[model samples]
Target: MEYFKKILRFAKPYRVYALLNILSNIFYALFATLAMISLFPMLAVLFKQTEPVFEKPIWNGISMGKEYLMEYLNYFVTQKSESGSPGDTLFFMVAIVITAFFLKNLFGYLAMYFITFLRNGVLKDLRNELYVKTVELPISYYSEKRKGDTIARITSDVLEIQHSFLSILELVVREPLTILFTIIAMLSISAKLTLFVFLFLPISGFLISLIGKSLKRKSDKVQKEQGYFLSILEETLGGLRVIKAFNAESRFSNTFKKSTKRFYNFSNSLLNRQNLASPTSEFFGIAAIGVILWYGGQMVLVEKTLKPELFITYMGLAYQILTPAKAISKASYGVKKGNAAAERVLEILETENPIAEIPNPIEKNTFESGIALEDISFKYGEEYVLKNFNLNVPKGGTVALVGQSGSGKSTIANLVTRFYDVNEGTIKIDDVDIKNLKKESLRGLMGLVTQDSILFNDSVKNNIGLGKKDATLEEIIEAAKIANAHDFITALPEGYDTNIGDSGNKLSGGQKQRLSIARAVLKNPPIMILDEATSALDTESERLVQDALEKMMRNRTSIVIAHRLSTIQNADTIVVLQKGEIIEQGSHTELISKKGAYQKLVEMQSMG
Candidate 1:
């Protein structure tokens, strides 16, 4: 219920709809009880049991409230029978009963009608917030998490919360109120019989609660298995090329099958338990009715203390409690199931992003002097990827970072972009600490083109203009020309308006990289970081992409992290890193003259 309360907070915005639902439910419950009670007067009229009365009954106080209501109804029946025939009295009684039932169904529909808006409204807001938080979180947050689990939270888990939340409102306001009104009517008919009914109800309620106790644990397994299989499915799609290339299709298929089989078992157990709720509750309801029949029989037939029509009406009211009781029991299990999903959904929504902005952050829009990495130490976990590292990149100059795979070339680009903050030191952009700068304003100063040319399934024009929202077609084409991507784009079907399929798979490696470069160029930021932007292409593709990079790098403060030494030979300064430390720094020619680590690397590459 702690989690239930937290999930309900999302429904706060839909209070008006919630209020309307509750208000409609109140009327529905009242009418539902009255519908059963209306049968009492009709039964009296049917059996010709009402004694004629000439005058109306007097109003009485609370202690005799039940007797007063009975007398008043009898007086009204007596007057109707006196003025007209017995058949006429019966017709009016049947009409009153019909009207009561009609109002009951009408308000019931209205309750659900208003609740629909509240339920769907909460779902929309929760999904929107989860997506926003997912995007705002640091890249490091995803490193240890599966994309599919997050996807499950945003999609299925939130859906669970929406359903569970609605069930809660029903349990709290509708079903319980219906049961309450029904019980009150039963008490009015026979207080002693009502007291007898309570004895069996508590026992049935306790047994129902016991059955639902393990439901949350089973539901957790079901939701977790769903996330697991979804992860496998997501991975299979993403790495289909690799799976096929390695001839491991059967392995992935078997893995997915195993997850689905688990899901099958978990769902069976969960739904079977949920299925038990209805029958179990109904059985207990019938059992209580049996007990009521035994006890109330003595009052009606043997004791000569109760009226036949009132006893029948009391039984009708007694049966009315069963429906809402069964509903509450069923929804209690749903709450358990929903609570499991709520925990998963709230876990993501309530996560604190480590890369949060400061209260008084400096909104730096311009990059003038340089980027400084002073005494910086950073790590993804325990072992530092960069330790006490330092560098200075001047304005309008090209600086290349070259290292082996684990030596931290890409780490430099990540730090400079503020994707991950340094552990022990301050990274200053134009002499202002990045920690003090607003994240949006800091990232706005730079453009990044990574090894993976990430592009959405969008048009070529939209992809190029992604960074600059208001960029005109002329600006887009001009940027594409500078990145050497204009000719191929013009040759594509529909030209700039052509749809690039998922991750831009419709284009070649070189074409994709050039589009990414064109995207950076369109942004026209002061600082450009190219982290192995041409590393994954064929020889021809690499050459075409490198030419685009060279053109775009002009008059920009550039940080080029590359492995192909030939590309960075003309860099204004070449910084060579190994094991998270810089062992050499100079122009390529000077590094060649050092006869050190950089020289040895160049010699080996030449041999290759």
Candidate 2:
């Protein structure tokens, strides 16, 4: 119920539809009672009970208001003479019953009609908000979550809320109101009989509540299992080549089968428990009906205190409570199931972004002499990855970082982009602290080409144009020419329009890296960061990518995180790192003359 309140804010825009639904439900409830009461007149006439001597009058005293109403209604049933045929009165009685039923169904349809807008409206806004949150959240957030779980939350969880919980809102309002109207009519006939009917209700309610107590726990398990298998399916599709090459189909299949087996047992238990509500409630209702028959029969036959026709009408009203009662029981179970999904959705929406920008951030218009890191330190966890690190890249010059794995070469690139802020000291661009600058303005000055070329499932032109949305086709081709990717791209069947097919799988690794460089070239930022851009390629591909990379870096301040020594020999400055500290720094000539860490690394790689 608390989760429902949180989700209700999405419904604010559709209040008009919600109000109309409530109003229509009121009419549906009233008509449902009228339909049941219509049975009374037929029961009286068929029992030969509505004769002039014995038609039960609605009022006892001769008050003008009550007397006038009673006479007005009796005018049509002029007590068929005792000698007249029963068919004379029975025809009119049947007409009243049919008319009552027709009006009930008509109002019920109207109730559903008004509720449709509210259900779909909430669904539309909920999905929109979830998508916005996913895009707005910082990149670091994705490092800790499973993509398929997030996907399940957006698609399947929202659909559950729509079909299962939202559909019950129509019944929640209408069923309770229908019960209220029917109970009031029963009291009008005889308060004592109505009182007897309600005595067993609380006991029945307690039993139904027991079944739903564990439904949420079971439902949460089922949804989690759904995400687990979905994640495996998503990964398998993306890495089918790796899986087939390693012959690991049995391993993935076993993991998938285990998750599905848990889902099977959980769904069976959850649905079976929910299914018990209908029959359990019905059985209790019938038991109550049997008791009422014995007691009410004594009142009519032995005590001669109640009329048979009125008593029959009272019994009909008592039975009417069962339908709505069963519905209420079912809705209670639905709430339990929906609560789990609602909590999952709210968890994402309510998550506080840890890396929000400052209220009033600075803006650096341009990079001047250089970017500098002064005693900067950082850690992805407890152990610092970059401890007291320092470097500088003068504008229009190249500085390269060479280090073994886990020595923080990539962390420096991440810090410059502000993907993760430094923990210990300040980083400045042209003497201005980067922390003071607006994030977008800081990122606008730079372009990045990483080891993995992150391309979308779109056309070659669209993929490159991501760096600059309104870039013309001619501009895109120019950038690709600089990247040395123009030949292969033009050779494709659709040229620039051909789809890349998920992370550019249609292209070779070297071709994809070239395309990534073309995107950066299209952006044409004043500063560039190339982190292992050519390390993953063969010698031939590396030479080609390196040549294109050098062309793009011609007039830009470039920071290259390199693994191969051959790539950085001509860098304006090369820094060698070990154990989160700088061990040597100089040009290739100066570092080799020092005969220290840089010289040792060059010696080892050259020998290998």
Candidate 3:
């Protein structure tokens, strides 16, 4: 219930719809009760239980409102039957019932029409917020979470909340108000019998509550198993190539089958308990009706304390309670299920972002002097990848970092881009701490190109122009020519408008890498961080892209993490690293002359 209220806050924006729904429901409930009560006079005339009043009844005060209305109805029926035909009176009574029912259904439809907007509106807002949060979360958060689980929350779980919680919300006013008005009608006809019906109702309510006690727990299990299987599906689709290469399709299939089996069992248990709501409430309602028939029968037939027509009408009103009672019971089950889903959705929405910025943070838009990494230490776990690491890059100077795998070369690039802030120590740019600057402004001054050329399934022009919004066609072509991609792009089926397919799979490795370079070149930021951009390319492709990279880095402040020793020979400064510590730092010529680690790496690469 607490979680349910939290989700209701999303309804604030759609309060007007909610207000209209409530108003319509109020009229619907009134007509629903009146629809049944309107048939009382017809039943009285048909049963011949009461003598028709030929004289008009005097106006009665509010104290005798029920009695006054009864007398007026008898006098009206008497006037209709004065033509010596009771058929006319019965027809009039049926028309009154039909009119009451017509108004009841009309307002009922209006209520549903208005609630639709509120329900879907909240769904849209909730989904939009979840997507924003998913993107805003740090990359490290996904390292421990499943992409499919997040998708389930956004897609299936949110829909469950809409169907369960929002549907129950619709019933909250209409069903209970129906029962309230029906009970009022019953009590007015016979207060003694109405009070007698209460004895079994509490017992029925208690039994219904027992069925829903464990519903939330079981519902949570079902939703979780669903997320688990969805995660497997997402993983299987993402790694289909590797799965087929290893011939492990059977293994994945068996794993998915096992998850689905558990889901099947959990869902069955949940639905069986949920299905009991309707029959259980209905059975209890009939039992109450049976008890009323026995007691009210003796009062009307044997004791003669109750009027036959009034007792018959009271029975009809009591039956009306059954429908809303069944609805209320079903809604209680929905509440439990919705509460479980609410917790899952709120888990994502209520999460606190660890990467937070200060109020009124400084906005540093340009890099002037240099970037300084002083006394920095970082660790993904207990063992530090970088401990007390220090380095500096002067403005417009190209610095190359050479190291083996797991030697913290890429870590430097990640820190410089603030993808992951250092665990300790400070990174300063132009004498101002990078953390002090607005992240957007700091990133605005830098461009990054990674080993894998990340491209979307869009036009060649759009992919390159992603770096600069609304860039001119001539400007896009100019950037492509600088990156050595212009010739290949112009040869494509649609030239710059060619669709790249998924991750640019339609293009060759060299062409994709060149397009990535073109994107970075378009941005033209003051600082460039190239993290093994050509390590995955063939010699020919590397040569072409390397030429483009060198031309682009001529005047930029570049921090190049290189895997191939041949690529960084002309860098202004080359730093060789081992185990997160620099073992050598000098020009490529000077490092080769030193006959140390750098010379050994160059020899090893040359032999390969």
Candidate 4:
């Protein structure tokens, strides 16, 4: 319920719809009760049991209103019957019943109509917030979490909340009011029988509560297992090439089948328990009705304390209570199921972003001097990835970082981009701490081109234009030409408009890399970070991409993390790293002369 209230805050924007639903439900409840109570006069007309009243009943105070209204109705019916045949009176009573039922259904439809907006509105807003948070959260957060699990929370679990929790909106107001009005009608017909109903109700309620006790826990397990299998499906789809290459399709399939089998068992358990709620409550309701029939029978037949027509109407109203009671029980189970989904969704919404920007952060928009990393130490968990690492890059000066895998070369790129903040020490840009800058403003001064290319399922033009929103067509062409991608792009069927397919699979490796460079060139930032950008390409592709990189790096401050030693020979400063520490820093010519780690790496690469 605590989580439910939190989710309800989203309903504030659509309060008008909620209010309309509540108002419609109120009228629906009134008509529902009145429709059942109309049965009394019809039965009197059918049985010819109505007593004729000689004088009109006078208007009385509120306390005796029920008695006065009944007398007045009987007087009216008697007068109508005296003027016409009994068949005419019977027809009038049927018309009244039909009219009452018509209004009841009309209001019921309106209630559902209004609630639809509120329910769907909450679903849309919740999904939008989840997407925003997914993009805003640090990349490190995903290192320990499953992508498919997050996808499940945003998609399936949110839908579960809509189906179950929002359904409570319909139940909380309509079901309870239906039961309330029905109970009131039952009491007016015969307080004694209504009191008899009270005796079994608490017992029935106790039993129903017992069934719902473990429903939430079981539902939680089912939702989690859903996420688990969805994670496996996402992983399997993303790595299908590897699975096929290794001939591991059967292994993954069996794993998926096992997960789905468990999900089936858990779901059956949950739904079966939910299914029991309906019959359990209905059985108790019918039991209460049976006891009323026996007890109320003695009063009408033997004791003569109740009228025959009124007793029949009282039985009808008593039965009416059962439907809403059954509904309330079922809705309680839904609430339990929905509560579990709500908890899962709120877990992501309520997660505190560790890399959150500070209040009133400095919005640095320009770079003048240089980037300085002084005495920085960082770690993913316990052991440090970079311990007391230090480096500097002057404005408009090209610096190259060379290292083996896990030597903290990429970590420097990550820190410079503020993807992960340093665990200790400070990174200053132009004599101001980079942490003080607004993240967007800080990132605005740099462009990144990774080894993967990272193209989306969009047009070739749109992929390149991602670096600079609303870039002109001419600008896109010029950027492509600079990256040596213009000729190949124009050769495609649709030229710049050619769709790239998934991850740009429609293009060659070199073509995709060149498009990535084109994107970075379009951004045209003062600082460029090339992260092993040519490592995955063939010699021909590397030569073309390297030429593009050199063209883009002119008059720009660049941090190049290179795998191929030959690419950085012309860099203004070459810094060689070994296990998070700088072993050498000089020009490529100077490093080759030193006969140290740099010279050894170059020799090893040349020999290979």
What TM-scores do the predictions have? 0.97, 0.90, 0.96, 0.98
Ranking by TM-score: 4, 1, 3, 2
Q: Model 3 over residues 280-350: C-alpha lDDT tens digits?
A: 99999999999999999988999987888788788998999999899888988998999899999999998
Q: Number of the top candidate by TM-score?
A: 4
lDDT of 1 at 121: 86
Tens digits of per-residue lDDT for model 1, 1-608: 89988878878998998899899999999999999999988998787677766577777788788877777777888787668887888899899999999999999999888888888988898898889999998899988888888898888888887776576785678888888999888877788889988988788899989889999999999889888888999999888899999999999999999999999999999999899999999999999899888899999899977889988888888888899988888889989989899999888888998888889898888889998999999998889999999999999989999888999889888888888888898899889999899988888999999999999999999999999999999999999999999999999989999999999999998999999999999999999999998888988888888888888888999999987887887799999999899999999879888889998888878933
lDDT of 2 by residue, 86-172 (tens): 696788779889998888888788878878899999999999999999987777788887778888899888887886678677887
At residue 132, what lDDT does model 4 achieve?
Answer: 92
Residue 505: error of model 3 in Å?
Answer: 2.5
lDDT of each: 0.89, 0.86, 0.91, 0.91
Cα-lDDT of candidate 3: 0.91
> Which is superior by lDDT, 2 or 3?
3
Name the weakest run of 10 consecutive residues (lDDT summed) in model 2: 63-72
Clashing pairs in 4: none
